[model samples]
Target: MRIADIYKGNTPVLSLEVFPPKPGYSLKSVFRTLDGLSDLNPSFVSVTYASQGESTDRTVEIASRVRDEYGCESLAHMTCISHSKEEVASVLDNLEDRGVGNILALRGDIPADFSDDKRDYHFASELIAEIAARNNFCVGAAAYPEGHIESKRISLDLDNLKRKVDAGAEFLITQLFFDNRIFYDFMERARYRKIDVPLVPGIMPILNYKQIKRILMMCEVSIPAKLLNMFDKFSHDPGDLAKAGVDYAIKQVSELVEEGVEGIHLYTMNRVPQVREIVFRSGLREKT
Candidate 1:
């Protein structure tokens, strides 16, 4: 199913994201994690594309497995940071041939191994324009609720996002955020900026203290005081920490739904229990 169709469906939707293993690591564990989550009936699952130096062929292979073997719709991440127009087109054609129907276009990181001749495309808008020329799949793009870390300013990022949409992005999945208020503010700003695509709020259930810090370091998201206090109380207990995290995520989703936000995209970390608890407690399964 296309992500746009999922968002346009009647009931509130829940989705998950997963990343394929690095070059040396075995894919057995990764596939196990995805298979475990398959029973949850995710609206769709996303498989991330690696940066330039990494192996993206494996990523696309796994995405195809998720759809063909497990009966789940898959969204393959496509990046432009180090790929040429020809390379990007070839990858898109490969995905379409494999029966994958959705794509999450991105501007991936520039890996240290990049050589002068290897680098080509820069912005995600370039890829979006290329995808628009074909009707093979439903296209999705990333949005930063608090603003992209690389952006000079949020206003500039919004303008860039509008261009991506105008080029033919069907929907947007935001970078993960803990605070719903920031996402709400982003939605209003996007409206002012005339970005009218359906925006799905990315929600991450912080399962560990170290994980939270890693994400903050990587993405430049802010941690609210209330959530910090929860972490302070349960940081030592892995079990308690997980409980607090899921409880907190449930509260976040409840409030976001009350505010009538579009959808909740869970960065499930390939953990089914967290995803299950969030879906169950958010009162969505009952409604569905």
Candidate 2:
């Protein structure tokens, strides 16, 4: 199914994102994770891409399995960094052959040490336009509620987003943010700018302090003061920290639902228990 059609439904959409296992790790382990996630009956599951060699193939493999074996729609992430047009075409052709219908186009992060003078794609909008030319996939792109870390201004970020949408991104999924107000403000600005595709908010439960902190630093997302205090209070207790994190995510999801947000996409981080808890506790499963 086209992921864009999901937002057209009256009911709220719930989705999960899982990354492909890194090099030397067993793909079987991810299948076990998918088994648990599939039971939640998510609207779809997205498999994140890895720009490296074999890991890229694994992205297509996992996404195909999610759709074919798990009986759920699957969205595959495709990045255009350090890749030529031929390489991008090969990946897209493989996905199409596997019957995958959805793709999230990204201008991926370039490695600091790896510099390629000749790259076919520089921006995500260019990738989106290339994908649109095929007329084959439901394309999704990333959005920033707090503006992208590299973007100078939020308005300029939104302008870039408009270019992406105009290039044929059917929908957008946002970067993770702790504050819902930030997302709401972004939505208001997006509407004001007349970029009206379905914008799904991405939520990541704060599973571990170090992990989340590292992620926040990389993405430049601000941690809310209340959440910062909770993290400090639970710093010593792993069990308590996890429970508190799940509680915080549950609260966020509940409020988003009440506000009639179109969809909630959880970054599962390859762990099922916390995501399952948040989904049930937030009453998302009940509503669906």
Candidate 3:
């Protein structure tokens, strides 16, 4: 089923995002994570593609397995900035052969090793348009609740987002954010701009203090002052920090669901236990 259709169901959509195992690593671990999460009944499992193509095959394979082996709908991420138009078409063909139908089109970050002038698709909206023209798969796009890093202002970010929607994005999944208020505000702004597709909030549990801090720095995602404080208090204590991360995510997801958000997307980071805990504790799913 298209991920967009899942949101229209009576129950809230519960989804998890996972990445392909890195180059030179065995797939055993990631499959284990899937096994651990199977009982959670994720409405769908999305596999992220590597822009550099190091794990592209693995991404397709994993997404296929998530459907064929795990009995869950799967979404495969496609990064077009680093790929030629032919390359994108080739990938689309491969995904179709694997029976994967949903795609999250994105203009990936430019690699430091490559110059910008050589790419075929310059923006995600362009790629979204291309995929939409195919009419074979359901396409989703990424959104930033606070604002995109490349955009100078939130209004500009929303403008780019509107282009993606107009180009044929069926739904949107936002980047991970700590503040729910910011996401709500962004939702209102996007709706006012006439981009009325379902907006799924992405939530990542703060598993590692340093890693989360570095991500916030790179993505420019705002860190609520209180969350920053909690990180500081637990920075030196790994065990305590993990516990705190779960607790915080439970509360965060609980609040989002309470607000009647159409869907909640969890960034699993390939860790199943904590994600399982968050789903049950957040009341998105039961312990059964």
> How accurate locally is residue 196 in candidate 3, as Cα lDDT from 0 to 100?
88
Enumerate residue pairs that collide in model 2. Answer: none
Candidate 2 positional error at 237, Å: 1.2
Q: Rank order by lDDT, top first?
A: 2, 3, 1
Q: Give per-residue CA lDDT, model 3, range 97-158, as digits (tens).
A: 99999999999887878886777988999999998998889999999998888889999999
Candidate 3, pairs of clashing residues: none
In model 1, pairs of residues that clash are none
The candidate, 1 or 3, that scores higher on TM-score is 3
Per-residue lDDT, model 2, residue 135, is 96
lDDT (Cα atoms) of all candidates against the true structure: 0.84, 0.92, 0.91
Models sorted by TM-score, best on top = 3, 2, 1
For residue 231, model 3's alpha carbon misses the true position, in angstroms, by 1.4
Q: Model 3, stretches more than 4 Å misplaced? A: none
Best by TM-score: 3
Cα misplacement distance, residue 246 of candidate 3 (Å): 0.9
Instruction: Show model 1 residue runs off by greater than 4 Å.
Output: 112-118, 286-288
For candidate 1, the per-residue lDDT at 145 reads 90
> Could you tell me every candidate's TM-score relative to the true structure?
0.92, 0.97, 0.98
